[model samples]
Target: MAGEDEIEGRNREDEQMHYNSTNLSSDWPFNATNDLTNTSMAMVASSNPMNNASCSSASMIDSFCQTPPTIWDHHPTNSQTLGAFSDLNMQNNPTTSSSSLGFRKGNLLTPSWPPPNSAIKRGGMFLPPPTATPTMLPHTLSQFPADSGFIERAARLSSFSAGNFEDMINPFGNVPESSMSPYNNRPVQGQPQEGFVNGFKSTSGEGSKDLPLPVDCGTNDGSQPKNDARQGGSGFSGNNLPGESEYSEGGAGGGGGQDETSDEGLGSKKRRRSDQDSDYNQVKRSPQTPNESTKNNTEIQQKGDKNPISVANKSKHGKQISQSSDGQKEEYIHVRARRGQATNSHSLAERVRREKISERMKFLQDLVPGCSKVTGKAVMLDEIINYVQSLQRQVEFLSMKLATVNPRMDFNIEGLLAKDMGVSGTLGFGADMAMAYTQNPSQLAIMQGGIPGLGSSSSDAVRRTINSHLMAIGGVYKDPNSQVPNSWDDELHNIVQMGLNPSSTQNLGSTTPSHLKAEP
Candidate 1:
């Protein structure tokens, strides 16, 4: 009995050791049970706010170890906790999960460079969806309301899932072989096998070589000839004429030649009919004069307008010629009359005369000192008269002083004239006077014969001429005190009066004046 009991005890010890080994081998069952219990407690806590707060500390610790916290785990434990983060969350409840997560609050609140609005947080990093298509994702994203941040984020994630990203920027650089495999191999819906670049097939693809040139979508207007031309990649300048077969002309051989000939005949008839129709259309479009209407019918009957551009140019040229002829036949000068001005011929002449006088006054105003500031014409004229009188008085005073200084006047007039001429032969008046006397003794004889019509004596004429000659010799000294009476003041005054009123000369008559008489 003791031996049997020892054997059974040894077996029991072996069984106990086996059981311990199995427990050490794996803890999956305990871990699974713990996960289930934690999930059930989380669901229960989510349903009841009071219960959640009681387990808040435990939940917070469990959250760290959670592989991925559920949507319920994302919810705040109490209303106060959620209310605290309400200002930070700008989205619906689903999106508020990321904002309300206490540990993730720093990342959610801290701003990113481009803003993290387009992306979602997963494992504390922004990640995109893995199965979205490049072609249709944008349209899908567009369907969501702009204010719905959660839907926008989800659409963006779906869009990122597609492998084909035509223009997306990847700041993370080349993706790893393992992580990229799922997206790279997966086919995207509604995306072309060969990618598109600006509506053209990407030349990088091998199949692009076989692809036909893209037809212009806008040019298909149901016109057979034009459609064929556009499809052939030629505009209106195709090698074959309007109705000829392009293929038949290009190495189509003798067999197609008969068909081409028959087609050519038919083409000629069609072209003739089209030309007639175009002529009718042109005639209808253009405005027709009586002469043009008659000529157009004749032209259409003989032959349709073959060259419409040349015809248009000819018509334009004819119009220009007629306009030139009309312009030459009747020329007009445009003259605009001001608001208060008269337009009659007599008034025009009077206006011109006033303008001439005004211009002369303006010129005199510039020449006279202290006259620039005077606004009234009458005041300016008065100033000018006073200035002229002052000048005349100064000349008389200087002449009187010259006479007083040289009382005897012993200087010979002829000798002074010769000396002045010799000193400066270039002096215009002295040079001319010298040349006159020297070159023409007859003129001197004529002057000595006396002022003929005036009936003055030869001696008086000689005295007058010598005195005039002396005055012409600018710097020469003269004496009114000897030989001639002192009538210098009278002669100067008379000359100034004549200059002031030129019409007074006619009234002065042909008689020799008192100033012309020399003292005997």
Candidate 2:
């Protein structure tokens, strides 16, 4: 449990960090200090003449127009002009376009340029050297989307630093190192010392003025690029920017006061331009770089594997859950006999239960004090069943005594058992005779120990009536002839006839032999 909690906390912290990072990255474009400002402003200048007029009106210096006139010659149109000039020169001299004009590209310059643009470097990638950095090369690099192009350019620069040249290649499968390597089998050393190979200011023993800058970076001199290409390795020098030109001419309206822009506007514009220049620098300076973007993506994906829940997901079921009562919630497993069950258990059952409970509670109250404050219903329900059983046995004995005198009296001892006990009553012949004896002293004395038989009774009430009759049977019998009570017949009966004493029914007179006659 603790380990899970720890892992959860760590995951939350990581998620929070990633969220913040994402927000920051999104807002980055707004504060982008590395946008190609010079290119944007140059485009903006053409679109809104007000911007141009505002700048020129205020005497804003043209920073983008800072390069010299010769740079224009690097343009294809300018090259056509130069070619025409050469043809014009041919008319003056029979020597030809060769000696007078310059060295032929085949004899010197390759008609096709050296060092391919990157894979992302498409349409208009190769620009006039006057454009300088690729991002700020011209206002017309639209082969890639703005964000994608900018990011790719950033990646291209990083690639240079990290020496990942292969991935940053031209569509034609050419990269910078492909042309730069001295040997076919050599791999890119990508080392700091190799910086000399690109014609940085490397020392050559003790002579030569600054190594003559083996490559021309357009702005390096006041000469045209074709003229600059005559030197060894100059045609495709690694150090030279792709479109190196000595200078670029400012157009007629360049920096002239006819434009309403001001000097202060130049700084702001240049500041914005400088930012663009840096962005371009990064693109042009690009070498093979690290796959940081991929690594960060993978980290985010792996982090997802570690943490599955999101704040939104956790809160999806926002309803609070609470129990309405301290009770169980369950499906009805059984459906009982509704009102019938209630009716079956008579109200008397409740009364009896109350009695039992009262008894138990009294016992409990005595056994344990204040702790057992039994409710009345509970106390009444808590009966000792054995006590009820004993009472039933006594009632059964009394019932039997009544049954002896009457066989029809169907005594149900169990039913008679006071309802609370949940038991029926019982009966015995001896108890019935004893009950009869209790009702009459003389009859009881005559047949005190003898048992009597029973009579018919259909139901409980009838049986009770018969039992009552048995009790009376032991007493006097009213004679039909007189209102007088004769001496009671002590013997019960000889030949049984209803209500006549068996001992008194026989007649003895002198109508027979002397032995059978009465002795006088």
Candidate 3:
């Protein structure tokens, strides 16, 4: 009995240990009761002794362990205590148990553990069906209305079935046909239609009665009376032609007579008689006719005169009258004239002068460097003025520079005149000096007075001294023809036709005295 009890106690200990090792908590993702039952069964099976005499007891233990415990299956004495303890644990870890059982606040229908929102209908007797109140879904999902009526109508409309598609695509299938095109078919009145010939009405006899007959259609016999070739073929010198009598009778109420004559003669006689009558009436009624007729007769007589002087005088008077009238009109009238001036001798000469000036200006413009390309006279003049001013400034600057380099050198006018007079008296350099002066007066002036220490002397003394110096330097007496020295001063004067430098005077004075003594 003692051994059995000891064995039983040992087995119970082993079972408890295994149960503790495999026990399930509220965190397990399944039913806690089932987990606990399985863990207890495993503990009983593994902990039971195989050769022990309490095999039946082991079996009973396994069965008891396999039977899952409910919340109500605790010991009778400790039920209330265990229940309180479980309630405390649930309060403490509500999320753990709720998560494990897949129950949440807003998602009672679809729990977190299972695949969400399956097609399965879950409502039963214990749970009422979920009422679908209009919840605001995302815009991406609910672009259309949620009403079933609208959705059904839209679905019907959007359906791609053959009948619906054909109806939608062929909306005009029931339209009636027409025999004619939409454009108008009738021709417009009075307007020329396509492929139709437009004929014009004849206007041959529609002319005004006052209009004269055409010359080409009229007979020449009466309209243009035959000329007398013997009398210079003058058409006016003909008798028995339609003239004053026909015109007077026609104007004086002789309609019957004209009609009879017109029938007897051709259309020419009718036109000529009408024309003569009209002319005679006009001439007889005009107030100025007598004066005009006299003037015309005088003009014809003067034209036929054989006096050359009279003709010439008449022509000259006509020209004078025309010119005087034109001049008076031009002087008084404030009208703007056209482009070119009136043609006359004075205007022609002025035009020629202007042309010549323009040509000369063009030539000058081409000759000058850096001139403006524009052809305006003002612009050309401006550019030329600027260029000349710049050249003058350059010359002044160069002169200043030269003067600074040789401050003792003189360029006085008096000294140049003295030198020129001396050279003319001694060497007869009148032509050469004048030519040099004409070519470059400024340079010639500068060169003539460029000698050193000559600015202090009077014009006469300077002249005499310069002439003697030239004669001595050239080893020549008072002779017109002499061999000149091949000296630097002579070479410089020959090359530039200018005076020698003042510095050469010292060398020339030293050598010139010796050459003078040797020549004598």
Candidate 4:
């Protein structure tokens, strides 16, 4: 019934052509066969219920369908070969769905890249299809919901299922023997006996002498994708193309039911691939699936991959003295060699600089979320405390180092009322020492927990430890007098009022500040 409808549509067209036998062929390269085929396809499409009403009305004037035929064999009385189709009214009359007409029209000339949405760029920006580009609002492709929908749909279709992937990634079935199969025995130079075979270089099982020239191969040339023979293969010979036998088959069977398969397959391939966004993935980098980054990192670690060689070497060097240490002795054995002391005074000073670089590296490592196992809590806290303490120690070390260099600088530290130590505490260093320590008191307290007090022996001892810790961190000399300077009482009025006496405290029950030695 469907085939009759198509035939009837063509008969109607031929009936009209009988009127004048118009030489549409003169203006168009397409001949009667082409016209007949187009008319049939258009009519078949118009038979759809959606197209009936429009085609019914349009059936009257459309030159391709309704115009009475002009002379098919001769030029029409009209001189202009194209004049027959110049009936723009007739052109507008064949009211089949514009979508179908457009598709046919576009594919009529040549099957092209899928519409912009379907035709994904192999490796560049996603251009809205040629059709859509002209109509699209000026914006990024992501701005279009329609394009996104097509992208998702294409992704859905193209996503290879495990089974499909098995097909694509591994075309031949099970492959223990594909590379060394019997087909590969291309023995040289003779049509060997029935059971014999030729190996790779031979043109046939008979071992022909001529070998075809090599062509561009893929990442896995001889080893993979033999199924993509259309793209070319390492060993396939042109003997595969049919010559005499093909024509004989066509003459005998009128083109095998299967012979048409090539054309049909090509057509189907075009139609299948013409979807909107076929090359979308090609143009874009394949995004890692969720969890992919973590998975890849985990796999690498499990495989025991190490840092690049140079990096591995540097790490080994840093760890060498410790790794080779016998017990903690040599490892903790702080080298007291003063070779670099002028540049960086103490053993501790050099260690602190190394620690700072290590801490920064840890910070960088923590930037990647799942890539690291470190929470950084303990390490970070230790780094902060250690850094602050080092700054404090460096301040004190400079003071002592300067005392040896210049003595005048101490005056600025706390207005040293009496010249205590000169030559060692020269005019030059006193000011520098004070600026280093007391000028930034807030910073000092934040480092040491609080300022050093001078009330009792225990209080003095605590002050000494704080300064000792500072000197250790900074790689400087710990003063034997790490205690708060005994002159604290004389230097500040507040300290004097607080009193070094220690006697008034226990008996204060009867005396508040109000009851103290009134007015002098």
Task: Work out the TM-score per prediction.
Answer: 0.20, 0.14, 0.19, 0.15
What tens digits encode model 2's per-residue C-alpha lDDT throughout 459-506?
Answer: 343334433443343233322223111101111111121222222111
Pairwise lDDT winner, candidates 1 and 2: 1
Using TM-score as the measure, name the better of candidate 1 and candidate 3: 1
What digit string (tens of lDDT, one per residue) describes model 3 on residues 12-114? 2232222222222211222223334333332332343211212332233234332111111211112122224333221211111111111111111112212
The CA lDDT at 258 in model 4 is: 14
Scored against the true structure, residue 308 in model 2 reaches a CA lDDT of 10
Cα RMSD of all models vs. native, in order, equals 36.8, 35.7, 55.1, 30.1
Task: Tell me the spans in candidate 4 whose CA falls farther than 4 Å from its real position.
Answer: 1-40, 46-374, 377-382, 404-520
Predicted candidate 4 versus true structure: per-residue lDDT over 127-221, tens digit per residue:
11112211121221222223222222223322222212112112111111211121211110011110011111111100100101011011112
For residues 9-40, write the lDDT of model 1, one tens digit per residue: 23222322232233223222333333343334
Which ranges in model 3 have alpha carbons more than 4 Å from their true place? 1-341, 408-520
Best by TM-score: 1
Model 4 lDDT on a 0 to 1 scale:
0.24
lDDT of each: 0.27, 0.22, 0.27, 0.24
